[model samples]
Target: MNHSNLKIRARDERILVIDDDLGVGECIQCMLRIAGYESAFVTTAAAGLERAQSEAFDLVVSDLRLPDRSGIDVLRALREAGQDTPVILMTSYSSIESAIEALRTGATDYIIKPFNNDDFLYSVERALDEQRMRKENAMLKRSLKRVYSSRRIIGESEGILRVLDMIRRVAASDANVLIEGESGTGKELVAQAIHYASPRAEGPFVPINCGAIPAELLESELFGHAKGAYTGAVAASEGLIREASGGTLFLDEISELALNLQVKLLRVLQERQVRPLGSKHTYATDARFVAASNRDLKQAMEQGLFRADLYYRLNVITIHVPPLRERGRDVEILAQHFIEEHSRRLGKRITGMSPAMRDFLYSYHWPGNVRELENLIERSVILAEGSVLSLEDPPAKGTTAPAPGTAGEFLDRPLPVEEYMKEVVRRYQDSHSEMELAAMLGVGRKALWMRRRRWGLYRSGDSRREGTGKGDLKRSA
Candidate 1:
């Protein structure tokens, strides 16, 4: 068979072929070159191992038996040296066991000798594809690590900074964590950040909202259920706790768990074992526990709504996220960030906030915190028609009020009402006519003319007639 027609799709990929037979190695090398891969052929296992250690290749194709050493030995040596290049083993029909042992040692695939060219090329293609997938997965993991390291915790306020510090410190340990915060304060985000930063980062990070599921099925969700556990039970399934083994299980709104379920969860935390519903056997769970609550669990305990024992077990380490209103200066920063984010999402070119809009954002109290602010920004970005954001109404009063006793002094020691009125008139004289000012002040136009004259402020278009008008009387002074 003319294998020269086969082409390697990944031209930049490097391949190393190792075999004792010079003819076979050269033939494979020619085939790989035709396939667009850059390949090297070596007739000795020792030379192959040296090349693999000193250089990087996307894949290694090795014969099962060599004059000096077997391909299994080469696989073991590469694994011991921490070289993870995917290796495909080729063997004779009599040495299938040797190929299987090579696979066990770390060979990615195996092919029999005297194989068809198509089969040989298919094996090589499969190995290369697997190598590519492995590299892509590694890159994705690195990207996820970078993202989790930087933007995992959102706010930079002192309170939030302290919380981040705590998360970092506690993430290295296996102790249980309890995240307490208000709704929309990103409790789940905190839990995920902790899991991703921990030693169990490679494992799953399972999240379940405790309040969303019913009590009858909550146990089955946390602990596996047998195939015939109950009605409509058709197949045995692994529970979330088992699925999250070697990682974290984030229980959101844990306060809503009923007392009976609480007892079951407490048992799992204590014994690290889960007995599936209606199952005769129990399985061990290694998942790290990270529970979150928007309610005060201690208060719930006192009120007999939550189990005190479970609360204590879950609260080994506690992280509290401060609400957006209490995170001074972060409100405006986060609002602006959300505005920019939503503007890009909505494909709008809004330049910036108007002075009135800025004042409203700075003065208004954000009761729903960062999540609420994000929603509002999304709405504004979608509804905006022009470059400047039109503020619908003034900010609610008392949001920016001065400290007590300061406002009283500020109001009582006022000296320049007349001076302030004169400045106001002068500032608007160009744009506002006498009639407009009169209408705004709820007075006659003549009264406005008299006030403007008394204040020594006159527009360029004012009449100079010498009748006893309010302006003439004031001008006589």
Candidate 2:
């Protein structure tokens, strides 16, 4: 083993060496310092425990048999004190039972006394590696919790609250979950809610977008790859499966998975094991799988775009997120929530929107769903001129929402025909009949008819605007 290479392992780590023999303690201490580590030598278990409790140490080295107490006692003491620093036990010779006891007590590794310098270093190196992995995983968990906590699933509508109730019921189980909804209906947010609310909430929650990653790389992203598994493979890394071992793995856009990869996923689901790409050994996964798709997996399966078996595997427990339009007053609730949130963020004094504006929000078909509503509300807050939000600010005209102030300019100017037509349509679609809309725009009724067909703005039977006919739309241009 390369002792020189071992120097890098302890540069930033503090080590505690516990032994009654001054010579042995000093020897290990000197070796550790020379290898770029800060270390202390203690002559008794009491002193060792005191040092470990009082100061920070990345690793501890203790003799199995101490002058007054055993190393395992010291290990238990430290652990009982809530110290999880990795420890390596040293022994001249030990029975099998003693060795097993050391391991069961969480001693990371053991070394025989009079050990080869290289072997001693190897044991210390591995103990440090395990310690690092634990710290990193813990840090990740903390960060994930903080990030997800703020994104509370905000809604009071029947559809949304019911989805929340459904999530609560299924979260306590180990069954697979399938979330189906149109894009931007907060599918990922629902997935997060499930994970954070689950019994395994303390574990990691890893999310991967099946459609975002390329087909060639998606497999490795989910299942990971072994060292030298493919071209550009430089090191072995655990995939989402291992990362989310005790938690949840969220696979968004599950319909986008290739059939072959889908088959591999199905096998993993059945056997509860995943073999990384380019690795021979398989690892057991206790990860709860929550998959989501904007596309209809059943429809995809019928069209041969998705596998029926894989669909069933993912659909163990299904959740359908209704689009924003169907969520009743959720639009207003969400808009008000956004007002408060973004107002706090932007340091704006904005209080609320006009009631007409709120009612207008309730009437539109939110094709883009909750995400769209959130975006528009955010924009209105930032660009709004007053504390009460209205349509004219941010110039949110010609959108699905009502635009109250921009009609005159839109109608007076000979803007680009398409832009003009679209704005006029946006401003009046909810308020005018086909002929009236044509007359108001000063375009031939036949021309307006052609524009509607080309844009596919409104189906024939669908109401163009929200209210009952207050006035007849002009029939002539």
- Candidate 1 lDDT over residue span 98-210, tens digit each: 76677778888888877778788788788888888987997689569747664846667899998888887998899999999866677888888888777787789999988
Off by over 4 Å in 1: 1-90, 94-106, 111-140, 145-149, 393-477
Which candidate number has the best lDDT? 2
Segments of candidate 2 deviating more than 4 angstroms: 1-151, 399-477
Q: How far out, in Å, is residue 177 in model 2?
A: 0.4
The global C-alpha lDDT for each of the candidates, from Candidate 1 onward, is 0.75, 0.79
Question: Best by TM-score, which number?
Answer: 1
TM-score of each: 0.60, 0.59
lDDT of 2 at 105: 97
